[model samples]
Target: MVEGNNSEATKFILLGLIQSPELQALLFGIFLVIYLINVIGNLGLIILIYIISLLHTPMYFFLSNPAFVDLCYTSSVTPNTLVNFLQEVKRIALPACATQLCCFIIFVVCEVYMLSVMTNDRYAAISNPLLYTVIMNRRVCIQMVVSTYLYGFSVGLLQTMLTFHLSFCIINHFCDDIPLVGLACHKTHYKDIKEVILFTLAGFNTLFSLFIILISYIFIVFAILRINSAEGRQKAFSTCASHLTSITIFYGIIIFMYMQPKTRHSLNTDKIASVFYIVVPPRLNPLIYSLRNPEVKNALKRIIEKVFSTVK
Candidate 1:
């Protein structure tokens, strides 16, 4: 193994999801479909929110950020993965790997923070419907969105900086189970620090976001229960149910992908989990939001009708 240096030999081989040519072809086709859906769905949601005046609200405002982030998240991982499936060498240059690591962390962090903000938005709506608008005002919503991006960028920058400073072997492969920090340090002495940083960034961030989301939902549930009318309670819950479903699918897979002990993961299982972690959430977010939320559904119909009219 060669030490990490900025030379012609600084590339690493990526084994990809599978080694067999037949399996690679099958995986590529599946991933291509998933990637296209992720792109269209996320882009459609963002455009739909922007053009539709009726959908302009703090909740949907927060919703737009996730669509944007998920668009970026899937783009970072899926395209490279697709290319790798078709490659004979399966080797990734050091620069490309670094870029992937940077983008992957940034989007992952953005997703967690944005979901937490969505839960908080829900909490505001349920806990005080009268004051929901006031509490989740334009200014507060903007700040929350800004904070999510800043936090995501900060974590990505730190991890990237940490990795690039240290030396690494020439042939290391990119693995979702391993963090950039873990990839850098080859010595046993640094293993403790490496594990700590990896766990702190991947595990702590997710759990922390989940804690905030969980707390917000607890209050949301209490508020719904206190509503005098069954219709009122259902109305309140309908707003949050979509976000809750999204949170469940996203966080569940991400936790399994990054947080669980390595011994628990098998080779095939790991690849499948990673695919769902990176690709499935983005592809699913638009469908979940549109199907569950009335405003988005109506906005989509308007969009389609307008497009057909223009074509006619």
Candidate 2:
């Protein structure tokens, strides 16, 4: 992202997904619906969790943060994409693009590690139920959530600033180049530092967070196996079902999308994969919790009934 080496393209035109007008229109409609659903579902769950007195435990407390992160994650990317679907040139102004990239990175990093934090919370609950409350008190939960954000901010800001500062244009562009840094439209210059910084950030963030999540789940699995009662074991597993599903879905898509060697993958596939990866997870997070967890289901029913009674 260094200066003076790249063309002074004030705007980068995204080679939007499909060149066909008809396909573009169809995609526009489809994504618009998905965006709306994502917003409503994630926000609805966060509101419900906060409103329901019965859902005030450490688990729900952690759940609410992820719900909000999901909402923020959706907001960060979906609207701009929806706009791109209908545009003629798919142009994003320089400053606007920088802002979008920053927000996207922040939420993405927060979410990757937040899943591990939740896993640790689950391990404590399953393995040390007697001290779960004390282990995850109000202050501790807030600190954990805050640290996730702070870590996200540091990783995102540094990568954004460093990567964006380096120039990434030219005929022989590296595979791991920045997502929308005018690479398609301009041919400038490049260096080894560019690859180093990008790889370092991506590798460090993914591996560190992944290590924490795997370790926590290992303890969790060992604890679950030791429970003598079959029902107790099932209940413990059920508690982690939602988070595990989220981790599996998101990490599977994202890791495949980002961590691959750029040359082996097609840009078109990358675009489509990223679109689904970003949009689907947020939309599904709440639904997973609501459908799988009895508490969320009960709270939703109770709220609906109370609303109906009021209306009547």
Candidate 3:
């Protein structure tokens, strides 16, 4: 008999997305398709951006970063989630779990800031067309990219260090306790503190980014409305529509996931929200931009024609 505190339930089975076997199989298949699409779509966007000289603009520059971020974001979780679905053992190594958490946090934070940067880029283009180039020069754009990544990495590091410092007692179980930090702990003072910190960081990052976007759009909308020509208003709104769609999807899920009380923790809910960030965004981003942005569409067509001609 294993003697330890009740909290010593070392290895907690994930129950893998759902408890029903048939549902598990179906869900796995669905997610597998989604993951594949996400990979291909994001990769295609990146490749298209690189090859398409016409897409060499500040907006596309910001768009490409998120596409890259989405690839890394989805890869961090979906692959492991797929593996867990297929196997009897759904255990993760302690180090691996920590790494996943860190990477996930990093990319998520980066994406949030990158979206904000994109908003600023749009603001410059729409609100100050004359100075857009001067304001968003190559150096400034590169700085924004670097700042986003560095900020994300720093926050992720701080959270990882804070989380992994807690001790987990051993228990009688087939699985290792270290691997499941969420389940392995009997009690730790830092859990609530760490969670609060994480939530605060997420809130500040998301809300701050969102505030900037909203403010920029408010000015953009004002500028569009002042234009005597209907065509000008339509054009202005059209330019922002795709970014707005992406912003809504991204921040809506983020708010739903992070803005709740700590007592509301549920693995199923977490996994679903995670899917929005990891799977849906990546798959939908290219489609959204390509459908809405004329430049991306033309560039894609040109690239496709060039490739076909080369093959011939």
- Candidate that would win on lDDT: 1
What's model 3's lDDT at 99? 80
| Model 2 per-residue lDDT at 132 | 94
Tens digits of lDDT, candidate 3, 1-312 = 122654422332444556576877887898899999988888999888887777787778888999999899888878878877777756665566668778888888898988888988888888777888889999999999999999999987887777666554431111211222344354666666766677788789988999988888888887777778888778888999998898888888888878777677665566566566666777888789889988888887787898899999
- Which candidate model has the greater TM-score, 1 or 3? 1
Can you give the lDDT of residue 70 in candidate 2? Answer: 83
User: How well does each candidate superpose onto the true structure, as a TM-score?
Assistant: 0.91, 0.90, 0.88
What global local distance difference test value does model 1 have? Answer: 0.80
Of 2 and 3, which scores higher on lDDT?
A: 2
Q: Which residue segments of model 1 deviate by more than 4 Å?
A: 1-8, 165-185, 265-269
lDDT of 1 by residue, 56-90 (tens): 98988999999999999788877888888888887
Q: Which of candidates 1 and 2 is the stronger one according to lDDT?
A: 1
List pairs with backbone clashes in candidate 2. 1-165, 1-166, 1-167, 2-165, 2-166, 2-167
Worst 10 residues of 2 by lDDT: 168-177
Instruction: Give the CA lDDT, 0 to 100, for residue 211 in model 3.
Output: 92
Give me the runs in candidate 3 sitting further than 4 Å from their true place.
1-13, 167-184, 309-312
Stretches of candidate 2 above 4 Å error?
A: 1-7, 167-177, 181-191
In candidate 1, position 308 carries an lDDT of 100
In order, what lDDT does every prediction score? 0.80, 0.78, 0.76
